[model samples]
Target: MGTVIVVGAGIGGVTAAVALQRCGWGVTVLERSVTLGEVGAGISVWPSAVAVLTELGVKGIDQAAALSGPTALRKPSGRWVVGAADLGVELPVMIHRAQLHGLITAEFGPGVTVRTGYLVKTVTQDDSGVLINDELRADLVIAADGLRSVIRSALHPQYAGPRYSGYTAYRGIADVRADDGGETWGQAQRFGVTQLIDGRAYWYATANQPAGQGGDLAAVIRRYGGWHDPIPAILAATDTALQNDIYDLTLPLVPFATGRIALLGDAAHAMTPNLGRGACTAIEDAGALARHLQSAPDPLTALTRYDAERRPIATKLVKRSRQIGQLGQLDNPLAVGVRDVLMSVGASAARGAAALRKMKQSRRDHSSAGS
Candidate 1:
């Protein structure tokens, strides 16, 4: 077996390297930054990815994170629209992005090497192997870089870049304790919070702000500062928050693998965070890729199998995530009214109970299929 070169050391890259190394493949991770770290605030992992993590022997996530509470969907006027009590699954578990990164990076020991500050220039692949910068050769190359993947561009030069979803997001983590999860829906704006295991809260607000405009936390406070209980307090206690113009790629969700070189995570299918599947989906991608590679006969065949199995599922998830974001960002009066009505009607205790049942069934189906 030859060495596998994985570009970028983000969650997806690290997970891939770890999984491949466990399968007896030599792995090297090249990261552009000087160190391995996460800039984002928080991430939610769903049960699908959690199962994958358990299979991979990645531990401590349960202790470092907190399960999200029932989500309270409210109207712009602060009226209760829907409570996530009906939604299926454990409302995604929230963990600081840095904490998750640290956990994944700790798993790379003898067979895996991580190199930082190595900005990849180009990639060329032949029948025998792939070469990075025309110098290093490997039996396989994994482009887990990110949405702005340089390797992706080299592979698909004619493909379009990531498209902005016409919205901006503001996120902050505060050191305040809260009992229940919170969410407020306003015309063209939404705010929510999840309490971390440390008792601190990770809150986020999204609005129809201008692209590239830095989020003004003070302005957000002034606009939505008067909403409901706990929000005012959460914002008041927030020492700092990061803001960014939310964007999603318009590319068709397709298999990103080309021969022995492959793409994973955001590089493969970057979607909105509305459904909270961003990190979870990436983790699932790592798991699926690893599983295929371990069982396949050769590197090339394994990469192909990974694409065939993952492309359809990931594409559907991408579409669902975008739709959810669009629904939350609706500002029209009539549309907002309809959305609120649907939420209220759909958020009953019975509905929630039914959702949990369905979720359990779905998990079983997935497990059976994988087996």
Candidate 2:
């Protein structure tokens, strides 16, 4: 079997290692941390990602994941903006991020070996093989090091780092049942809520605060305590909340691969989480790379195909995500009013489409009954 090296032990990295291992490659995953862990929050996997993970032998995610859909957009004063159906998307499967990470890690099986505490300070690709930190060489190198990836910087030094979108997010799991809780968009801020598997609630909010500020729960409570139903309760019920500044890569990489090394996951395209497609796209990259590796003549050819197939799609997604983020955080009153009006009109159109669909189904049922 050929040898492959995967950098970082995140969801994308581990998924890639397992996929390659199943393809009969001896894979080594190098992780900077001594232990495997994920942040305490929820992740929603769209239908596309759920299918890919299931095909790769991971199981029971559907049972564990609560469905996330039928959400309503509301104003901070509790007026309706639109329902989620207006956007025309399939329901995403929601599970804890750590649970998904563990499932991906478990699929490593015996074909892959994981080495911890091995930080990849440098990556260089030679004609024979790619080298990591100048100590180890493999036929291929997959960089899944995350948003501030050193490998990415090495590949394109001209690329500037992540751009802060002038927003900070607070995430936490609250031991409360909030069924009608969805997203609320106000002036320069937004709040969202969804249910977890065990009847708990997963809530998140983005604000116009400076990056890396407001790392306390009281601050969150002060800002949103009086907004709407369940928001105050969720915050008050939370034991603690974790905060992070939202940053995304604005500049698109022309090509996602160079020589023997290829980028994956956030390292490749770190888009905003506005569409909830960031992780789904990363998982897609794993499946795509694995497919090409099995079909191509060699590792280099496979990397080239992976780059060609994934780059354009990811770049387009990055642009869409940015647009959504900008629209969601609009502070101007007139702009927000226009957006709400359009959303209201779109919701009407969506409802009309749904009624048409139901009518067609009813006709089919009646015809079958008459037969």
Candidate 3:
């Protein structure tokens, strides 16, 4: 058996470490941060990812999070747009990001060694093994480093960097409680609120803004300040909030590997958060990678198989997520009208419920296939 070195302790890295360790590999995780921390936000785990986590033995999958139905897309004035119920695996569950990270970290035990604050400056590999920071050789090196991956640049220098999606996202956890979870779409902007397991509401807003332009929370409220029920109240009740410019990287529908080193998660295919599949896809990557390694003859062959199995699905998701973001940010009057009309036609309660059933059926089919 040989050692595996995984960079970045984000969701993908930690999950990969645990999965590989179970396969009898000695794993070392190097993280640049001093401590494992996650941005204060909520993440929706789709059924595909829920199945992955359950397989990993992650605890509290259904309880430590809010198990809700799909979000109903509504107008700024609180008028019903269309409920996502028709698209439907229990409408996905929302969990605090840090909690999920902590759950994954707990699975490794003594089989994995995690080193924080050791930023990988460079990487070099040969036929024998891979090296990190000019030293430390390992049979396999996994880069889950994230959007600005040092290993990715070292391996694929010709790759185009992440591009700003011409919008910004504002996130906050509010004290208010909302039972029926959903979102409101205003012109060029959108807002969503969902309850956490602890009963706090995790909310976010996205607006059409240029890259690098920070937002004023007060100003955003004033702009959309007059919108529907609970939104104004939710924004007003927010104790803290932060804004980030949304960006997506160009992920080709190809394998993100070169010999001994391979990329996973955001490093391989960073997508917009529109469909809430970013972390879910990463978890799926971990499962696929683990399954490949467990069955293959060697690490190199296993990585090749992993790349082949994951690239197409992850690439399609990245592209779909970006498209969803574009649709969410439609601001022009004519475009907005058209979008509203489409939503009105597509978002009836019956349609929404049917979508949810179809999503659930897809999950069932996938699970049965995997079994």
Top candidate (lDDT): 2
Per-residue alpha-carbon lDDT of model 2 for 142-168, expressed as tens digits?
999999988999988988868898888
lDDT of 3 by residue, 1-371 (tens): 78999999999898889888887889999999999767668888888888887898877777677786357888888888775654334578889999988888878778899899898999999999999988878999999999889999988888786878888998888888877578887778888889888888898889987788788678668766798888888878887778888887875633577899989999988888898888889899999998988899987888899998899888888899998888889889899889888878765756766768889999999999999
**Off by more than 4 A, model 3:** 84-90, 251-254, 348-371
User: What is the descending lDDT order?
Assistant: 2, 3, 1
Candidate 1: which pairs clash?
A: 86-352
Structural similarity to truth (TM-score) of each candidate? 0.92, 0.95, 0.92
Error of 3 at 320 (Å): 0.9
Task: Write down the RMSD of candidate 2 (Cα, Å).
Answer: 1.8
**Model 1: which ten-residue window has the lowest total lDDT?**
82-91
Flag clash pairs in model 3: 85-352, 85-356, 86-352, 86-355, 86-356, 87-355, 87-356, 88-356
| TM-score of candidate 3 versus the correct structure, residues matched by position | 0.92
Q: Which stretches of candidate 2 lie above 4 Å from their native place?
A: 360-371
Over the full model, what C-alpha lDDT does candidate 2 score relative to the true structure?
Answer: 0.86
Model 3, global lDDT? 0.85
What does the lDDT read for residue 315 in candidate 1? 83
